[model samples]
Target: MVSKQFQFSCACGALLAAERRLAGRQGKCQGCGAVFEIPQPGVLSTAPRADAIAVQEVCGICQTAIAEDDPRTLCQACDLPYHAECWVENLGCAAYGCSQVNVLKVGPDIRIPSPASPLPGSRQPGFPQAGQSPLGASGYQGGALPSAVDRAAASPTLAWDYLWMGASAVGVFLSILSYGGPSAVTGLAALVAYAFQQDKSHWGPAATSLLLSAVGVVFGLRLSLLFWQAT
Candidate 1:
């Protein structure tokens, strides 16, 4: 779910055909540029994507180009393409402190070991295989981001999020009904307080902050007008 198809190459400057997924700590491709999906795992392809290059299906790990006639269902975390059997035999979840949950087969399998699923896409995001970026990056590329990265990016503060949402709503309500008084100021202050607690490092918090602050400002202006008229 968090995985994205990166249109860029690995941390190295090699040109890769398939999109790269973030894996490991470095956010680089699991195999980086050295490993690639192909007829063989250890074997490297002279041609990145042969003749306009179509991997048919990519390894979902490394950004390698599988050979036209190769047999493999998935690639290692490093992006080393492997046949289904090779994947089951060689690669599995390696996260520490997580048993039965971390190591398991993709989709479903008896040997890989995972909770059986009755429907497709039933698995949640942030799994080990998700969010694997290539070892590193520098320029622009197109591809879905890895699931892990998304989770790492998403900071869950349920209470804080709710608090801010409530404050913002109160601010809106005051602006509409009170026409500027304690209610208006209350909304303004609440909005600012809520914004400070929001997580915008990953998304565009700055923009939201500006927009919300502007609304508060307008409320304050209306309040000033009301008080001035009373004077």
Candidate 2:
């Protein structure tokens, strides 16, 4: 015959069982590492009472039916039942206000929860907290740092830089036919494009545009001066 066991709970909400002979002895709670004196005989029951069995309780974490014969434990704080596996998977009691909500390892995995992981009901890595907007209070979405591609896409001056470059090219072509009048505008447009460009990769193209605009200005001015002197 199997010897009878006595069931007791720790202050941290861990359910513990010991042989009936070990009653009134000191025991340590595996959940929070708290040592406490075990209650004497008749203080706690080994199994759920008849009324509790008839109610068909569910696991607090998974919300599934817990069979009468299934391995389970109860949270000492809120008196909620949880499956043995569910308790280990969730790391502790799933009740919201229970003190053991963040308590680690009521089950076999005795290691503490990693600090990098967020506790239950807390904000996740990519999510916004309470009262925060979708883009977050800091204006970045998903709480992630802005990447190079993101900065490039959001740059307001990039469009203006390209527009100035295009204007510079058009002005240079006009200077070839209209003498020095268009060269002045072409040189100014090229200077603005070069100054506003932020990306280092485009520096070579900007320099080329500036040089070509300068040459156009000089050529047009020389041609205009020569023609005026001859006429």
Candidate 3:
């Protein structure tokens, strides 16, 4: 006697057999690793169900009815059956009004994610938390760059301390060679340039230039006096 059975399908076209009592329960497929819910048992009939028929149906593409043991393929979108060879020849689903082009390989489908899985748009694993910018830890607010970037942008005036220090070094070298007036004036002017920069944020280089220029001015005056006395 033929045993009563409930038949269902996976998204990958794998046919599944389930007991009548196991209906509405979740189970994994043997052919494919797909998790699916077992369909409720329908009324027993000698003839097959219109949609969920067994392998004993005629191929929609080739019109040849296949035996129960013959290999077959079924359309997941339309539940239409076709012989495996005919399905390959047709290149896709043969059901009317269905436009599916690729035959699905038996694998995972209709998956129900576990409860522990991270929700979409939530902070992903190893990613920064909310209110933190990817660019840096500071100089930004609400993910926007701070206005100080625009205020402290590259300026020609910032280069003054560097140029003044160079000019002061050249002045000191010239004063050591007894060229007094122009060398002393150059060192004094460099000191003034450094003074203006001291009130700004670049105090380190400004302070350095201030000390060097003061020493250069003193050296220039002493050298000029010794040269004048010798003449």
Candidate 4:
């Protein structure tokens, strides 16, 4: 006996098919990656087999006749048919202005219940409600909390700052003793530190380290020039 298959549309508008035995089971959409329950038999309107309608139906994305037994899907928004691969490749419905265009997955429609109004004279112990002075009840008179950027800017200097500064100073001392090779290496270290610190949003330390490193590099270069001139 041939197993019957049922067709249904995913929330993201992709057409899907499942066997009768698989009805009411959760299935994932291949085209848009949505997980949905396959409708039980008689619940969803089943379409005729692709083999029976191959002559008239074509894939919307490739404009090619859909072959019998080929994996296929339809855009729920516009009812446009597409090969499974074509639908996934195009990302969503190819029809212009279709709500499912480029949509990977559609979330379930959820209705949020509005907060109930408090009964008169009943106090909820928590953060101050709208229009209530935070200072009056919570004693939080420091004004608005610091933003993320402000907190980042106010962050204390990291250990890497000291390491970079020390390396630069050592390089400057070594340059005075040698001919400035160590200074170049330390200059690169300082530059790396600046980039790392700047990426972490430690602007003050990054700038300070870079400035000191620049001075050391210039001093080292000047010494190298004098040493070479003497030679």
Query: All candidates: CA RMSD in angstroms?
Result: 23.3, 19.9, 20.8, 18.7
**Superposed model 4: Cα runs more than 4 Å off:** 1-157, 197-199, 228-231
Question: What pairs collide in candidate 2?
Answer: none
Q: Which portions of model 2 miss their true places by more than 4 Å?
A: 1-166, 176-179, 229-231
What TM-score against the true fold does each predicted structure earn? 0.24, 0.26, 0.27, 0.27
lDDT (tens digit, per residue) of candidate 3 on 19-98: 55446644556555554555687664444454653323446776555556788887777766678887787777876578
List model 2 lDDT by residue over 1-231, tens digit each: 656655556676666665565555444455565555557755545563332212234567876666769999887787677898888788888988898785774556677778655333222121111222212211222222244235335442333334334444555555654575555654554455445434434454356556666766777677766766777
Candidate 3 lowest-lDDT run of ten: 134-143
Poorly placed runs, candidate 1 (over 4 Å): 1-68, 72-85, 89-164, 180-184, 187-213, 216-231
The TM-score of candidate 3 is 0.27
* Whole-model Cα lDDT of every candidate shown, in order: 0.37, 0.53, 0.51, 0.53
Write down the lDDT that model 2 would get: 0.53
What is candidate 4's TM-score against the reference? 0.27
lDDT of 4 at 128: 16
- Tell me the tens digit of each residue's lDDT in model 1 across 1-231: 423232334445543343333222222233442543322122233344432222234443343444557667532333434445444554542333324222454554446535442222212221112122111111112232343235334432322233233344444444443453333443344444434432333222223433554575577567757876887
